[model samples]
Target chain A: MKIPLPARFRTPVLLMAGLTLLVALATAIGSEQLNFTLTEMLIRMIVVIGLYMFVGNSGIMSFGHIGFMGIGAYVTAWATLAPEWKQVMLQGLPAFLQEHTYPFPVAVLASGLVAAGVALILGAAIMRLNGLAASIATFAFLAIVYSVYSNWESVTGGTSSVIGIPTVVGPWTAVAFACLAVVAAYAFQVSRYGLMLRASRDDEVAAQSSSVDIVRVRLVAFVCSAFLVGMGGALYAHFLGVLTTDAFYLALSFVTLSMLVVGGIGSLTGAVAGTLAVTLIVEILRACERGFALGGAQISLPRGSQEIGLGLALALVLIFRPAGISRSREL
Target chain B: MVDPLLRVPQPTAAELAAEGVSVRFQGLAALSEVNLTLLRGEIVGLIGPNGAGKTTLINCLTGFQRPTTGRVALAREDTAGWNPARFRKAGVARTFQAGRLFRDMTVAENVEVTGVGLGLDRKSAHSVAMEVLDWLGIADKAARTAGTLDYTDERRVGIARALVLPPAFILMDEPAAGMSDSEGEDLVGLVTSIPTKFGCGVLIIEHNMRVIMNVSHRLYVLDGGRTVAQGTPAEVQANPAVISAYLGADV
Candidate 1:
């Protein structure tokens, strides 16, 4: 159906509508357990699409974005947790946060801003490096964030699940934010900044010769993508009402990046498709691992099938369709 | 009615000059005390052999290289250490010998990006790109991916993109490297019209002596990175030093 929007916005708005409808379908037909699964899917979609906004446009594989997600998740935890709980369990938070709990929207915005702020500071230095050096530097950055958060016992509760946060994120919230991420990313993809960025990606020399500031443009994309992923991380904090540093570590980074790659790392459509495709496969495998009842028998894959299956899937995609299923094509 | 794309920045008595510029590599002088200048509304040809430092000179003029000694001046203002992007923003644009088109973008996008980089809004950039493409007579190929263009078309798009920068001084590095005689004739016409049509100075490096002689109002001949001759096209063509230094080896 034709959406009465500007020509520049029509496709993204339509894509958002389609995703919302799919989530609505899932909500209507499924039980509460299914709602949780759908929420997970939507949240991952937001994070992966955020990755694409930077990686796809700049052709830079960032290993540090999930660090921004962790910051967002932790910020939301600090902001939304009851003041009484913070006094007893944590005292490192500033007085304002320690004294008052904020609404969901306020915490989400704070999460995104704080994450983006950190990205701006770090990306200034990181974006100066290129190719393999940039990749390794980002990886090193991710490790540093993980270590700091894991050991900061006073503020972070360190290496353990920080609980007592309000559980406000549901399937609907997840769906709404996923749609927002999709639209925002699309708007950015066609913006002049995005155009200059993709130009640099194709040929750094050509883009510079055209008067593009390559480092500055990459940093802009970095900060913008961090904002989206940070909010996605905040949703995750409320989804389960617990924050664990492990959940925001290397495993999360690789899984989200794999979704981007397997779906087509070059296009936003690939980000969405990769996340959905990989999430469904893992969920199905998890169900089998739990032993599904078959004809007069219980049949199941062995334990730890999900991780193994993900590896094989990524390997197969790289071997046959290295560009991913969408092949970087936009909607 | 004049097209908006044609209404570029005023000529402003602009002059892009390399004064006593010298570049040395590991104690070897690549360019020794070379000086050249391009003024608004004039076309000058720079002719040299393979290692005559023509591309290196273009790099110095356009901010890709720093001369070991001496400074480049734009409009009589010294450009001490400007980078390539800064030089481009100051209305000096150049194209590579290799035709470095952004392979992933469409032909129109290749030009539009330069316009946008030059601070035009997206809508204006697109219109300017369309106008430039139309003027180049390749408007039909606007939607084709740059990587998919044939060799000749890549060169055309390269020139089109440089023009979209609205440059006050343009340095082309072997723009007519590979083309038929008829195609070369068309290029000669295009080079000739650039100064009058866009109010920009042109410094073209082409090995085709016939084409360069036909298009240039004046010529600067470089052999072994030093000026062999500099004068009106006729004056330079008849100089024994230029014929012996350049045409002797080339033809």
Candidate 2:
């Protein structure tokens, strides 16, 4: 789903399908280290696609999406954690989450729903603002969610990590969810509401005059985008078997959004491509930081170089290809 | 495809009116105590010089502006607090002086979005979009990126977007702004046919006296935001106030 996709829509769909195939092939044939990196990269891809569904179509950047991801991770963690673990760590949880362990699929569905529910309530108020003010409000929202989760000890385990989540999700499952996000986001990209959302983004005056309810369409996208990002968070919890609110804080927001800008903020292809390119680049940078022998000489970069490298990459993309590597085109 | 969206109920004797409407921005009066009416099955011309508040009145009638001292009514109900989007959804559409097409979208998407906003499913919206684009003779340009169009075609696409709404009262603001003489003549045919062909009332804002006079079933003339004269084309042409307001601008 590139921005300004020609009406055909098949090529971008095929592109996402192709991404799934490569992930499957990698996990099946590649080494353990490669599988680990692929899983993380695919999860980031799903998160970016969720971001694209709202930011790409509505032209509203959000710093709060990772906040949804945190909510989802926590919800899924609460659902799937061993009852004994929950009873110990999250004493303030409702009776249902504290005493019962749901099936993994049920936990996953609950994560998306809870995130979407929060989005609906918040978006109703925030979507009334436009442009920069709305963006800042979303950042504030993320900060508030972060502060609450970090301090709500009994319900959220406070600042401590909640463990004992089953680590059942692998690279193949990540790929499947990534593919599902792509198809759903693509369907929205071509649907009536998507077209209207993009229209409103292009020219608000023109769109409203055409009878497009600016706030309503924006809120709908906000809720739907939150649902997807929330599901991405669930995948993270299951993959790591741990939950930490700080992991879903400012750093995660910046890193995922950077992938979007580096790939193509306006197109679905850009979202996927950005995640793939940035994740791989960060992994390579880390691998370099941990010294490797090259022709009997130790080849290594200084520690903390990944941040510098990622920052430089983001800067270059912004200055040279402001539309992202996909140039906002799907094909 | 059946084009259910384009098959609007025929000519329900609709009326959009302004009673004693006036607008003041801070201290300057843009329009004062102005009255205008448009009815279905008719073509009405609203002509005035620059800053005469032709577009301002268009805004007021279509809910873009709230009159300081009057009410705008659609059919029989007062549209006092409606927004522009509600106005469009209620079957009143207006064009801007600036042809504000969604530059990044294809022309077809630009028109189809209106159908969707007005409650059509995507499939029906597409059918209506193609139907109206065909009617406006820009069906070939339906897939073209709207931003790439020349000024004249941009205006054409703007008109096509408005027509897709199938509005009961379509208020056109300088619909022929960038056209050549021949293109202007073509616009005359399109503007005049809107009432009979699409079953809508037309309010055309134009500087070109000849074109509006040629097509309007009735004429409403304004000067300095005041009603100067209104009647049949011949009656308004013979009025001294009308001639003086023209000031030899267009005879």
**DockQ (model 2, Cα):** 0.82
TM-score versus the correct structure, for each prediction: 0.95, 0.94
In model 1, the runs with Cα more than 4 Å from the true position are A1-7, A293-299, B1-13, B248-251
Best by DockQ: 2
Candidate 1, residue B78: Cα displacement in angstroms equals: 1.0
Writing each residue's lDDT as its tens digit, candidate 1 over B32-97 gives 899998998899999977899899999999898899998899999999979888888888888888
Measured against the true two-chain complex, the DockQ scores of the candidates, in the order shown, are 0.81, 0.82
Q: What are the clashing pairs of model 1?
A: none
C-alpha displacement of A155 in model 2, angstroms? 1.1
lDDT of 2 by residue, B171-247 (tens): 99998887787788787788888888888999999877788889998988888888888888999999999887855
In angstroms, give how far residue A23 of model 2 lies from its true place.
1.6
- For each candidate, C-alpha RMSD in Å? 2.7, 2.9
Query: How much DockQ does model 1 earn?
Result: 0.81
Model 2 Cα lDDT, one tens digit per residue, A190-257: 88889999999999988988999999999999999999999999999999898888899978887899
